[model samples]
Target chain A: MPVTLKDVAQKLDLSITTVSRALAGYSDVAAATRQRVLSTAEEMGYVPNVTARHLRQQRTDTIGFIIPSEGPRFSDPFFNELMAGLGNEAAAHEFDVLVSIHVPGVEEEAAYRRMVYGRRVDGVVIVRIRHDDWRIRFLQQEAFPFVCFGRSEVPGDYPYIGVDGTLGMYLLTRHFIESGHQRIAYIAAPPHFFFATDRKAGFRQALAEAGIPLEKELEILGDLTQQGGYLAMKELLSRFPSADTKPTAIAACNDLMALGAMAAIQDAGLDVGEDIAVGGFDDIPPAAHSHPPLTTVRQPIYQIGAQVMRTLVQLVQHEPLAQRHIVLEPELVIRKSG
Target chain B: MPVTLKDVAQKLDLSITTVSRALAGYSDVAAATRQRVLSTAEEMGYVPNVTARHLRQQRTDTIGFIIPSEGPRFSDPFFNELMAGLGNEAAAHEFDVLVSIHVPGVEEEAAYRRMVYGRRVDGVVIVRIRHDDWRIRFLQQEAFPFVCFGRSEVPGDYPYIGVDGTLGMYLLTRHFIESGHQRIAYIAAPPHFFFATDRKAGFRQALAEAGIPLEKELEILGDLTQQGGYLAMKELLSRFPSADTKPTAIAACNDLMALGAMAAIQDAGLDVGEDIAVGGFDDIPPAAHSHPPLTTVRQPIYQIGAQVMRTLVQLVQHEPLAQRHIVLEPELVIRKSG
Candidate 1:
């Protein structure tokens, strides 16, 4: 026979409401009382039923994170940091978070469709928004509570938390210019992703301010990947008409691509800093340990998750968000690469 | 005004069970039927009571993944692979997995203690067992169902899935001996870790069988870090005092340390393939991309999580497990490092 909540309350000589609040991890419950209820419940082997199942607690007490179905190789360092932060906060809230990856290649749409409809996550946190994002649209129409890591270029009045990529790129490009580089290159992603576009805007804006003419050949456009950068760098060097004035420095949109560009430069028998200074964005884990210890933009990756979670929780609880668009600053971390 | 399951059933002219199952994503229902239920529910603006406060169907449907609170720097290729694998499985099951980090200098043990005691998880998955692991012991004595990433050294009664590190090291060391490297060095972690101790034992066993004398100078111990490996290499090179016959090969227990050791060798102006061979265990993502790709022992990090989950699901269902100790094999991958 399954032990009932009533049985627990009766056994503990307490009211059912106290037992209920304590069992649910409610913050309002007194710590000592909650502990007693929890211990008693565990002792009784009481498994609370999730919404539709009898295995877990009545409330899912779970948050969901959805990463756009980006390619497998395209998994960003940003995701890892954000996840670590979300995990940290969720644990503190005694809430479990579920992360769903919608790989762009196979059945991307189906994953989100299932999560929103069936998985019925308590709230959802979406990262890496692209232009014409169906996800933002879905969340808006569905009125599902969500928080975005990077706001959509075509945002629809949904609560979002975004990092200042524009400022980050501006700072990175300024660093390269200050390091005594005249003709600079930008290893950027295509103008599809909002993040890519914003970063490019920042790059071009900084260069324009410095009175440098932006050349099409200098803007090495490719997917946001090291291999893409490697291949792009090869094409940039070979395809460019002028050999005498090769860009003295190249700034990558992300660290992985920066590393790849470095490899290509090294393969071409050019020193990274001596021949051409290289810089990257997203000061990922490998940024610190790279052969040259890459100089890049350092965004508070972990804090973003915590803030996003807190924001999502607020949305779920019908609390007023003082601001919808929460922007975190990206600091420039200079190393041997720049 | 609340849209109860009964209200939903009446509106759809279907039984309450059919309506419930369809919303719950049960396989018994037809796809079209499930679709209809979802569409209707969405139209009704129905949000399931995640707290499970009022609804009898409040099952959280969330799975708790207790990430070994170890930081990213401490993790090599093994933990990352496990996470990737776990992510795939968790997504497929339509369940969210929670992640938490345990920073070393920060509140490491207390962080874990809080997460578990807080009743945040339905079921916990533990990674990397320590010698006096309070978490494992707590789960065991309390009969809390858990799956460990590595087996406990003090074996004989715990549910765990892990690779045979001792056997893996023995094979790799035997390969080194066969390749005509009699004087070998093992760049490994502190002796406290079970994997390190087991690997050292394997190294010793291989040396004994090959009739090679064991030398203390050939053993380098430090933290499981790249810098640690680099520092260890510097120490081994300076203090060995045997300039005539230095170690011909070095095997790090993991890839990060191996890469560091490789860097250290380069800093020492020694050729990798020509002068000395270096290898590591648990083939990390960057291992393949290193200047000379590292040879390593490949553990099935992904399958470990899936298999552990499968085993855990069985435990949750009260199904009989064939064995409490699930031992996996580690394969030797030959690369440029060795």
Candidate 2:
């Protein structure tokens, strides 16, 4: 037989109301009484049927994040940091984060629908928003509470906290120009990603500001992985073999690619900073420790994670938010690589 | 009005049994019939009501892992890799992974109890097992289905898949010894961790086999972080300032610490491989990218994760296992660092 609140109240000679309130973590109950009620409940093996409670309360008290696994591996440090931030903040708010790892498409969409319509979570947090992301449209149509780490080009009234990738890239490109690098190349990310286009545009804007003609040959597309960056850099080097016209510096959309680019340059028997400077965005933990310490754009990934969760929680609680749409500035960190 | 399975069956001109079996993912239903039933159910706005179904089935179809966050950060590549492995494997089996990030103490215990007694997850996967971990005792008492990544010192009958840390460290130490280094220092993980003692013992055993007297001062304790490894190496360098008595090789318990040790060696104006060989355990992704690359023990983290989930799912399904306990071998990766 399951123990009830009355059983615990009777055992402690306290009112059922007091026991319930104490167990509910209400501040109306005395601290000593709350402690006593909790211990007595545990001693009596009074298991709180959370499913029933969640159903009754009309809240699951869970947040959801669908992990976008790029390629075959999901060990990207950026995602890890973001997850850590989300998990830490969610836990602090007495909430748990449910993760669904699926590639974007039919399966990913089904996962989201299952979580949202299945009532498995109170709210959701989405990342890597594309220009025409179907996930956002579904969430908006369902009127579910959610927050995104990246903004989409698709029009919608939703809360999002994103790093200004365009400005970030512009600053990085300008830094290279200041270092007397005129023949600059960019290891661009896949064009499908919204931020990829923004980041590349920033690089173009910086080149135009410096009165440097945009060279179509200098822009090499990469998949944003270490290997992708390496291959892209190799392609760029091969395209411009002569030192006189070859790019003296290369800026990757992210640090992983930049690190790969560095490896390619080193493999070509050229000095990293002496012969050609390299820069990257998203200074993940390894960026500071990379061979010569990669010069990259620093995104407050942890803080961004915490803010996204906080925003989602606020929306779940129907609380008024001071600011819904948050755009955080990305800082350009200079290190030995550049 | 809530849509029921019978309502969907009526709309599709099918029997309720067929509709129920199809929705439950039973193989008895024909593929075309199942698809027709599912589309009809969706068109009828039928919500499966997973909570009610879970209560009846006594399964959540979810796997749980409590992420142990250290300090204000949860960026440990080991945990990230482990999580990715678990997430990928679990998702493949149509199981969602529920993560709770909390420091080990009251909150952690509460999170576990909430998931277990609350029936939020069907099974759990635990990592970083301690000698006398309360979690193990509690889970054992509850008779819950679970799998551990690390073995505990406390005697208990449970299934676990762990790497042979002792042998891994011993091989690493032996490699350093074969390089003609008699004065080898060890940067060990915190003593509380089970692998810490095992790894340090292996290092000692290697020295013993070489007929080298063990110096008590040579065993330095580190917290398994790059920062901890860095500080520990600095201490070791200070302890033996002279070149003649200074240790020729330093073996860290993990790669992060080994990377830190490398940084320390470079800071002290010494070449990494020539001045002193450095070796680390757990060849994480960055280990291969580190300047001079790092020689470390490579654990198949992704495969280990998939195996753990497979084992847990097997147990949950009440299947017989040919082997309950498994020990995986750690490979010695030779890189430029050593």
Candidate 3:
């Protein structure tokens, strides 16, 4: 026979409402009462039928993580690590992690339909946001409790979290400059994504602060992939002379691109960190093991995911969140590449 | 005013059921009928109120995938690739993928609770099963339709897809022998997982066929992570000296272990290929880039996931399944380490 709340209440000699609240994980329940109810339930192997209870409570205890397949972020390893971190944190917080993938349609409505309608995940964690993204507008209008992995230009009152890409990029560029490098090439991602714009901003800011003029010829928007960086390097080598025109330093938007840059440099008969210095962002596990190692920024993606869950918990608990968007700074992990 | 389904149906001169079925992605709808209904809905500028629909349907259209924290199989790069593949397939099939982290108290029962009680997900995909897994029995008793990523010892009519670990280990072991490695040690994961047993069976089978005696001291079983493998490798080195008891070749259960073995060999002041040729299964991307380029089995994990979802579609549709258990063959990718 399925155990009911009344049976648990009778066994514990407590009122039905008290047993119900304890089972529902209500805060008003005394700690001893909650413990007794939990222990008795465990001993009796009581599994509450939550569907009916959830219908009444309007709480599902699940967080939906939406992975947008707009750019090549889906194929990258950074997203995978972030997912793992989120999975662990969600488990600790007694929440389920729902990962939904939606392809970029002609508009953002289709993507919204996938998450908001068909799936109906509790709260959402939106990754890979674009500049002037309709997703932000849709989420804002709905008043949905969500955290964005990337920031937007027109920031709103949404409690969001993301890496400080501008500062990370500036630090990397400054490190290259201090390492006796000039004419540094910046291999960036597409401007559609917010990170690309922020990274570009940092590069420009660092160059300006160093009293060095920005060279439009040295900046190429790569797709934040090794293949993209390789193609960009090829174009760089072809358009300019090896010694006179080719930049002495290269800062890629990601580790994959930095590795690609290294491959290109070696193929061009130039040694990395000697003939040419190279750096990347998102200091992945392999960043330290790469050929001559890679100088990159550690995004603390795992911690970001942990924080995202913690923040969502606060939101779910109806606690006040920060008015301004919380931006976590990235650290520079220097290695042989620089 | 919100656009209603009935209003859209009346506007299109179609039955409410037909309009509803077309919107819900029922394949039986005529293409012309679907296109007409969709265009009419677009003209009406309808956005589905998921909260209302969820209240009625008692569903989220999200299937949970449970990854056990006990095994290395759950958190590896190959696991990520499998997830990506599954995500793509799930999206194509119009289902959201929910990942639940497996813990002791919050085990597989939590998944069923979320699906049936909380109405968080419709179905589940269970990976890394032991012989006496409670998840299998619970789902079986509940008559819940689920697909196993790996098969069990006592299978009965439930849909299961598996990678042929026996054949994979046989091939890797054969490679080691052919490369003049007579004494080979098997560094594997914990003995509880089905794959570990299957892999051990194949290892013994190959050695018995080659007329090599099976030494109990040669096989070491531990955790599946790189750190786990590193610790196990250190223990193996301490137990077996390089001068006498050392095996010329070591067959690691997975690429993470293979990488760890390489590190262990280098830490022991020994060359990887020259002193101890190491091989691992699961040709993860890093296997190709690792120092000395790990030789490993290239299991089409993405294809496996795709196949599992495709098979689950049959179950969901109540179609005749061609096979109860579908086993995929593993490809041997020979690299410099072997």
DockQ comparisons of all candidates to the true complex: 0.29, 0.59, 0.34
Which of candidates 1 and 2 reaches a greater DockQ? Answer: 2
Q: What is the C-alpha local distance difference test score of each model? A: 0.74, 0.87, 0.77
User: Between 1 and 3, whose lDDT is larger?
Assistant: 3
For candidate 3, lDDT tens digit of each residue in A1-338?
A: 35667888899999989988898799999999899999997777666654445545566677877676545224556766678778888877878787766557643356565455433556777766788877778777767677777688755777678889999999999998888777899998888888888888888888999988988999987877677787888787777785777798999988878877787887787878888888999887667656567899888777777778778867876888764377888999998888
Q: What's model 1's overall lDDT?
A: 0.74
Interface RMSD of 1: 5.5
Order the numbered candidates by DockQ, best leading. 2, 3, 1
Query: Could you give candidate 3's per-residue lDDT for residues B1-338 as a string of tens digits?
Result: 35768989998888889999999889989999999999999888776655456557655555778766653213467767677778888777776677876654455566566565444556678777777777778777767678899878754678889889999999999888888788899998777788898887878888988999999888998577776777778888888874777888989998888787777787788888888888998887667766677899888777788778777766765678898788888888988787
* Candidate 3 chain A, run of 10 with poorest lDDT: A113-122
lDDT winner, 2 or 3: 2
lDDT of 1 by residue, B95-165 (tens): 45656566543455554444444444445687766776777777766666677878775544768898888
For each candidate, C-alpha RMSD in Å? 5.0, 3.2, 5.2
Candidate 1 chain A TM-score vs. reference chain A: 0.85
Q: Write the per-residue lDDT of candidate 2 for residues B25-98, one digit (tens) a residue.
A: 89999999999988888788787766667767778888899987666786788887888889888888888899
Question: Which CAPRI level is candidate 1?
Answer: acceptable
